[model samples]
Target: MSNGVIVRRGRYYWHLSVQALYDGKTACIDWRSLLPLNGGTTKQRQSLLASSKGLLIALVESPRDHRGERLAHSTVLNWVHDLRRLIRWMTSKDVWSFSDLRVTDIVDYMTFSTMRKDGGGEVAPHTLYMRGKLLHEMWEVRHQYPSPLLIDSTHWILKRRDDGDAVRRGGHLTSQLLFPCSVPR
Candidate 1:
């Protein structure tokens, strides 16, 4: 199927099935299949969920970045996962809109995520990098959404060191050492 979000049963469920740019196979996603929203009133939670779903729809429909190149299917899936994390974090803090998100909140989230335990350890460095990149891309595609993120995320730059470590600065995870083997030089 072409890249787009499909709403079914009067908005109770949404689905997306698109051709993967990397492999040219159908990639199917069921929107209602994600984890349930937590830590907010029903109305607030639903509003945020709706907005996020809209963002996902917009992203899938237009997969091109600033360079007019298509994004890989895996990249889009990663964004979907990252967006869920972002939404959960936002709702936890009572932040309902992207416009309401502050840089410090983002910083706090980055710190919180680093400390988040998965399989008895902190999240991987490459995972953090991907999350940071998602924030940048969210800003890049803000104009495509109905309610857009107002903050400028261009300053959140990711750079590779002389070693095979990826680091972000200027409003992102600052100086958080990444595993050398996880990132490419």
Candidate 2:
């Protein structure tokens, strides 16, 4: 608990927040620990828990989200697809493992998702938003809670062709458009 390290629970997961001081520069890092590994000998459980990859794989296969509802067919499929993509991305980046995944690696994954020769470009903003939501559902080794990765990735966005110009995002997504203003424009 010392050195500015704090562990706490969110809606369902355990969060480890640590502040690091290096070269007189300070930075904070947060990690979402996975769900507890059960149904094995102490040593076997420990071994599975020790490997972040294994932990992640278990999380992906979990039958339900943190809320305990049975995972929908599409949800499981998305998890499979995304997890595979993540593993491939990890290998391509030569990442040490899942536990060692850094925020930079996450950012890089976002970067990689946007490039392709076919109809693919970047993952849609809504898709990224949904993925962020799902991150909360999976990968809880503690209390089965939300992951900070979801919150962190919410800001992820790719540069659009009109980005340089101040073209506003469409207003249709907001409910304000549903009602007419009292004052005439």
Candidate 3:
């Protein structure tokens, strides 16, 4: 498993395509052009999943944000947590690799996370929504949208359900604080 993009050589496809370094020069070859010479067979399906190293590796390796400045530790930690949770859940389902994950798995996780903390009660909508958002962020490499590490391109378009995400807990909740005179004292 690699971390760049899909590369198909003849008929085999590679999920990650490393850059080339030769003659003291690194050529920017199209990742798709640099595919596996073996024409990916069942033996290579295991390789279909992105490397098991986890998104943390890609995050740490990215190091900088869009501005080329270092990302905050908290941001990094959030990414790590998301990746850890996803990996743990995936492993439990016998999915040992990231690419092995199907869109259904994510849908299932999202549905499960929204379940009530108790038996029949629901957590705050924000809690549920945020988890989906955070999980979505883990797919990226170098802050790229839709991530470079997916086996199914359709997953890039996947979105969480919008029903529970109302504007409940933002600053607007303090309408009175913004206008003290409006208080019905």
Candidate 4:
């Protein structure tokens, strides 16, 4: 099943739509229009549409029951912008779908974002980490429910880290670090 959004040719404007079949009924999504094919790069426009589709799916699978309806129009538009940026970044690295992501992919994306930029500054590690976390969260929600295909382990480790541990060991648990003044009086 092609989960990514598909480009549809419309009469007046190119309609970006995603068709999800649930219980033998089709859920059709028609996102707001793109500039009449005149202003943006073809790749940019297509990525924009695809990202919109991804967000629609994300909203449905969002932790919040009514994320889509709760967001204001301008906020929704801004989300589209953020989604487009994410898609473009992913596209540059040949990551076009959520399935393309892996543990290594998360590390690589963080590295890419944190590298010194042409503009002379690197993005903060915290920023890169935040983006990775958000993307991972989206992947988590999307896979929690059943899909057309049986979800594999990539989807199962949603709450767990790359390893199976609920709490990462080898921290300062055994140390007197928290009670600093208690050391060797």
The number of the candidate with the highest TM-score is: 1
Tens-digit lDDT string for candidate 3 (1-185):
13233233223222233334323432221223222333444443344233423344455455443544433334544444455555555555656545455666665665666666476876565555556655554554524422233533223333334432343543211110011232121
If both were scored by TM-score, which would come out higher, candidate 1 or candidate 4? Answer: 1
lDDT of 2 by residue, 87-124 (tens): 55655555434544555565566556545427567555
Q: Can you tell me which runs of candidate 2 are displaced by over 4 Å? A: 1-68, 115-119, 134-185
Top candidate by lDDT: 1
Residue pairs that clash (backbone atoms under 3 angstroms), model 2? 12-144, 12-145, 13-145, 34-140, 34-141, 35-140, 35-141, 36-141, 114-122
Task: List the candidates ranked by TM-score, beginning with the highest.
Answer: 1, 3, 4, 2
Regions of model 4 farther than 4 Å from truth: 1-52, 60-69, 73-75, 115-118, 124-126, 144-185
In model 1, the Cα lDDT at residue 105 comes to 68
Q: List the residue pairs that clash in candidate 4.
A: none
Better structure of 1 and 4 per lDDT: 1
Q: Give lDDT for model 1.
A: 0.60
lDDT of each: 0.60, 0.40, 0.43, 0.42
- Per-residue error for 95 in candidate 1, Å, reads 1.3
Q: What is the C-alpha RMSD of each candidate to the true structure, in Å?
A: 8.3, 18.6, 15.3, 14.2
TM-scores, one per candidate: 0.65, 0.40, 0.43, 0.41
- lDDT: worst 10-residue window of model 3: 171-180
lDDT of 1 by residue, 126-171 (tens): 6766777667767877877656677654354343232323223332
